[model samples]
Target: MIFDGKDLSHRALADRLPSDETHVFRECDLTEADLWGAPLAGARFESCVLDGADFRKADLDGAAFTGGGGMRIRFNDADLIDASFTDVDLSSAHFGGALLTDASFTGCRMIGAVLTGSRGTGFTLSRSNLTLANLGGCSLRGLTIEGVRFDDADLSGCDFTEATLSDCRLRGTRLLDTKFTQADLRGADLGEPDDAKLRAFAGAVITQAQAAAILAARGITVL
Candidate 1:
């Protein structure tokens, strides 16, 4: 079923949707729409305004969300395996208890998003702004992260083992108990890591400039 250029705001369409067909919503306004437990597997949402949309417990496996979005959208407990979100505004969205296995988010504005407690082996994020986001306990192992900003975000218990970070920013990020074992952070801007944050990066590879900056911060001059 295709819903193109439709205004479906503040409506409950979960029960009315046919479960046998693939759903496609393009250029639609779904603000505050209730889609809880909706069977939306392989669904395509293109340039849709999804502000405050509730998709809790929805089956969104292999779903593709492109272009438009808004703040505080709820996706808790949703099945998002193999899902992809590109160039979307997902600010302050909630993904607690969501299954995001193999999901990909690129060029998205995810500031203040809550991805903590999300159950998945891994997910991909690139060219995204995750400032002030809570990603505690998330595993980004062995992935190549590029152009992402994690400023002031909580990364407690995150696993970045063998991951490669390029052109990323980690300014003022909380890295308590985060693992970076064998990770390459040569191109990342790790702003003035303190003792704890520095300890979290143990076994990670860094560039000489980063090492110099770290030493310089401690009042030690590198000749």
Candidate 2:
């Protein structure tokens, strides 16, 4: 089923959807729409306004979300395996208890998004703004993360073993119990990491400039 340019705001659309067929929604205003437990597997949502839209417990595996999006959309406990989100504004979106394995998020504004307690092997995040987002206890092992910003975000207990971060920013990011064993952080801007934060990157590889900066911060002059 295809719904184009439809205003589905504040409507209960779970019962109206067909489970046997995949749906496509383009340029639709789905703000505050209730789709809890809806069977939306492999659905495509393009340029849709999803502000406050509730997709809790929805089956959204392999779903594709592109272009338009709004703040505070609820996706808690949703099944998002292999889902792709590109150029979407998903700021403050909830993903607690959601399964996000193999999900890819690119060029998205994910500020203050709560990804803690999300159950999955892992997900791919690139070229995205994740400032102030909470990704506690998440495992990003062996992933190549590029052009992402994690400024002021909480990364407590995250596992980045052998992960490569390029052109990334971790300014003021919380690294409590975070592991970076054998990770490559040569291209990341790890702004003034204190003793605890520096210890978090013990086994990680960094550039000479970063080392110089770290030493310079402690009043050490490097030749």
Candidate 3:
């Protein structure tokens, strides 16, 4: 049972679904719905309100959430490759080990979200607040993040190769073993990183003062 992108009510569409992905849901408001373990790949949810919806282990590859409002939604271990989320409220959301390659998140408010071990190859998160988020042991190459506040966030052993972080603030953020080879961090406020972290930020694009500070810690002053 699939509607051809036509307008349909939540009650009307739920009555026609086949308890699986065979029934396509287009542009419907599934707010607070129990959609756990649903195979809804290639489904287009335009401007849907999925606040507090449970999407644990859902196969949502190629899924599109445009102008969304899905706060506190669960996506644990969900396969979300090529998924695009615009204007989504993802506060306190958890995405552990989720395959998020090529995912685009624009104008999303992800305050205090937890995203550990999530693979983000070619991911884009513009204007998102990842403050206090746990992103340890994650790969984020070819990704672009802007206006992100990572205060007190755990970024240990996380890879940031060739990534762009504009206007990002890492105030007191944990960078114990983060890898940032060739990553651009211009205009970013990454206050006082440790020795191990300073080595990782050696080749990263940052202010000359930050580089000097890092080198100065090694007893090699640039006169």
Candidate 3: tens digits of C-alpha lDDT, residues 1-223: 5554453323323234454554454555666676667767776676666676777777789887766666777888888999888777787788887888888778777777778867656467777777777878877775777877777788887888888888888877888778788899876887666665677686788878877876786787987
Candidate 3, number of clashes = 1
For model 1, the local distance difference test gives 0.97
Candidate with the larger TM-score of 2 and 3: 2
lDDT of 1 by residue, 1-223 (tens): 9999999999999997899999999999999999999999999999999999999999999999999999999999999999999999999999999999999999999999999999989999999999999999999999999999999999999999999999999999999999999999999999877998899999999998899999999999999
lDDT of 2: 0.96
Q: Could you give candidate 2's per-residue lDDT for residues 37-118 as a string of tens digits?
A: 9999999999999999999999999999999999999999999999999999999999999999999999999999999999
Better of 2 and 3 by lDDT: 2
**How many backbone clashes can be found in candidate 1?**
0
Error of 1 at 60 (Å): 0.3
- Name model 2 segments beyond 4 Å from true: none
Give the Cα lDDT of each candidate.
Answer: 0.97, 0.96, 0.74
Residue 185 local lDDT, model 3: 89
RMSD for each model, in Å, please?
0.6, 0.7, 4.4
| Candidate numbers sorted by lDDT from highest down | 1, 2, 3
